[model samples]
Target: MTQDSRQSVYERITATIAAAIEAGAGDFRMPWHTDGTMSAHPVNITTGKPYRGINTIALWAAAQGAGYGSAIWGTYRQWAACGAQVRRGEKAALVVFWKIDEREEDAGDMDDGQSDPRRRVLARGYPVFNAAQVEGYTPPPLPALPASARIAHAERFFAALGVTVREGGTRACYIPARDEIRLPPFAAFRDPIAYYATLAHEATHWTGHPDRCARELKGRFGSESYAAEELVAELGAAYLCADLGLACEPRPDHAAYVASWLTVLRNDARAIFTAAAQAQRAADWMHARQPFAA
Candidate 1:
């Protein structure tokens, strides 16, 4: 395909995935159990058992939203691809993969179902290509980098929110329950520019804890509620990252529970809006906490 043609195809796939996630159609799997049971298994970090019924699925989804934000998968570009296979009876297993630019030497020896080694390989800024070889199709150029001054300012802003800043990695933010706020290893930051973008994301999560905004913040991974929370956090980070000129990260895990989130949003359009508003507030709150330079 011509370069432009390839780009168009990539964009179309990305858009389709985004649309599915927005509608809550791809977050959890309806696994067909051996004992004639259908259960919801979250697509992110796998759990041992399945969620027994729709009620359990809904509850799990909600808790995930409260704790993780709106989208469980993280962000948009992180998404690689999603596909489904029919098992037996009225059940199917859905598979989703996140794009990883770095390859680990140890990954070859590790067993399947173990913690992904790639998760530990710090991301090195936005728009890292998965390469057509990795994705089974050609992809467009990485998303544009946000302006720099704004990103620097955002870094300082997040530092004020108590998150330690690091450089050279993809955008990743986490709430270290014990520490005030710790950035992942500097090696994890693959590039200098994404530092602030990632910090903004973690800062949003910190907003959910009891000592901070006290959002609900609990859910079984991949439930409808969890998907919603992922969306909230995802959007929150996106807004903050945008203000500071950073590309929004991808949320590959969101594919598993996209359908669930859409259902909830459709059921209460106002709820989605409210969650986004609150997430924005949380981001602002973190920003305001930063210390002014001397």
Candidate 2:
């Protein structure tokens, strides 16, 4: 594709996510709640691979809006190939991928005249329908484990990070300077998932320490940068929760941030994109540190 095609796709995907975040700012809900149809990570039906980066945000928003409970998604042809038919009236969700093209002739600085690892990655999208939008398809059954059963996994997962977490505090926060997270006792929370959800939020924040991910952290209080970082932490936690099969309800404490997030989105159409990108970076950082357990 040409430059115009790449720009066209980038603009479309950014606008879709920005609109979703803006709409989510209204109610402080991004549709990752337990009450929603799909509580697990959004995945491709054909590939069974989880969607990552901004695509996760896009698909979750679409699934929440459409009340799609199934994780299965695929292109129209894919549905037919699987012996299923997309409902005639069912609209498909927009999913994107990067199309890379390498140019060996353009390697001007290479002494050996070899093609560098560099390649132009273009943003492109396709329309995919959820299994709920199809007929004659039965997704294999997977049970949603109870919060009690998931507690052990959540504990081991975060414990593997080895981040300093202190309980007994009413307010939950990550002190970047000290590099520690404070939270109320897990028992004080309504359930185990909420406890872990809040911890995941702070854990994401911890990943932003200068010694760690070293993200842009010097934002004025109440400034757009600060709001953007908070957006990243919250969304990162949501992504982490999805990874661990925990419920990702928007905390009531985050309600105060809606107006701030909305202000940032209103001023810059791409703010949500940046937030989603950083959020993915944060989630990936922690994911890399997660230890595999039998």
Candidate 3:
């Protein structure tokens, strides 16, 4: 893709998310908040792989805007390869690919940096249609786990990570100096899902410690960077909730950060992309701790 096209991809996706966030400001609903009907994570029907980073945010915003309950998505040719056809007038949503350009000059394995050309990561956008937008392809629906099972699974997930989590706190947060998460008692939450949702948010923050994802966590408080970090945690929590089959709800305290997030997005079109990528990394790090993770 040309440099202009790459920039357009970032701008386009960022604008979509910013618009969605603005639209939801009235009720604090984010594009990532799922109502238990639609899957939180967007997956490609043909590849059966979940989209990551900005692609996930773009698809989530598209799905939320279009009321698409099905998380399955695929490119035009991908759908065709699966014997599925997009509806004649259905609109396609945009996703991106970051490919590395590997043109280089041989340096003969020497330590001289001047011998090799630096590779560039290029961005390319592709249009995709959701399962609801296509014909002749019906994905098998997975049954939702019971509430008890869902909570049990979440407990085990956190246990596997083995992060120090102390309950019985009024405010839920991750203390960087201590490298631990503090959360209110489970009973303090309105429901079980809310408890886990808050934990997911804090766990995302926990990953930013120097020993983990190593994000700028030490002195970014009350600044744009802090808001950006909050956005990362929010996105990370939503991703985890979706992957864990839990319905995500907006935390009441997070409403205040929406304005800051919008400011960040407005100032930098790539802010959402950066936050989503960092959020994905944090979520991936947590997932890596799972016993079943490959």
Pick by lDDT: which candidate is best? 3
Displacement of residue 255 (Cα, Å) in model 1 is 4.2
Tens digit of lDDT per residue, candidate 3, span 67-180?
Answer: 888899999999999999999999999987755455321111111111134655666678999999989997887776687887888889989998999987599989988888
lDDT of 1 by residue, 1-294 (tens): 355643343333333333434434343321111111011122231122222212122222333333322112211233343222212232111121222445532111221122366564221111111111122332223344435555566656665676444433343445455534456565565565455555655667667777776666343222455555665566566556544555554445335545655565555423343344456557556656657523
What TM-score would candidate 2 get against the native? 0.85
Instruction: Write the candidate numbers in order of decreasing lDDT.
Output: 3, 2, 1
Q: TM-scores of the models, in the given order?
A: 0.43, 0.85, 0.90
Error of 1 at 70 (Å): 27
> Which parts of model 2 have CA positions greater than 4 angstroms off?
1-11, 18-27, 34-39, 102-118, 217-223
Worst window of 10 by summed lDDT in candidate 1: 30-39
- Among residues 3 or more apart in sequence or in different chains, the pairs in candidate 3 whose N, CA or C atoms overlap within 3 Å are none
Q: Is candidate 1 or candidate 3 better by lDDT?
A: 3
lDDT of each: 0.41, 0.72, 0.81
Q: lDDT of candidate 1 vs native?
A: 0.41
Spell out the clash pairs found in candidate 2.
Answer: none
Q: Is candidate 2 or candidate 3 better by TM-score?
A: 3
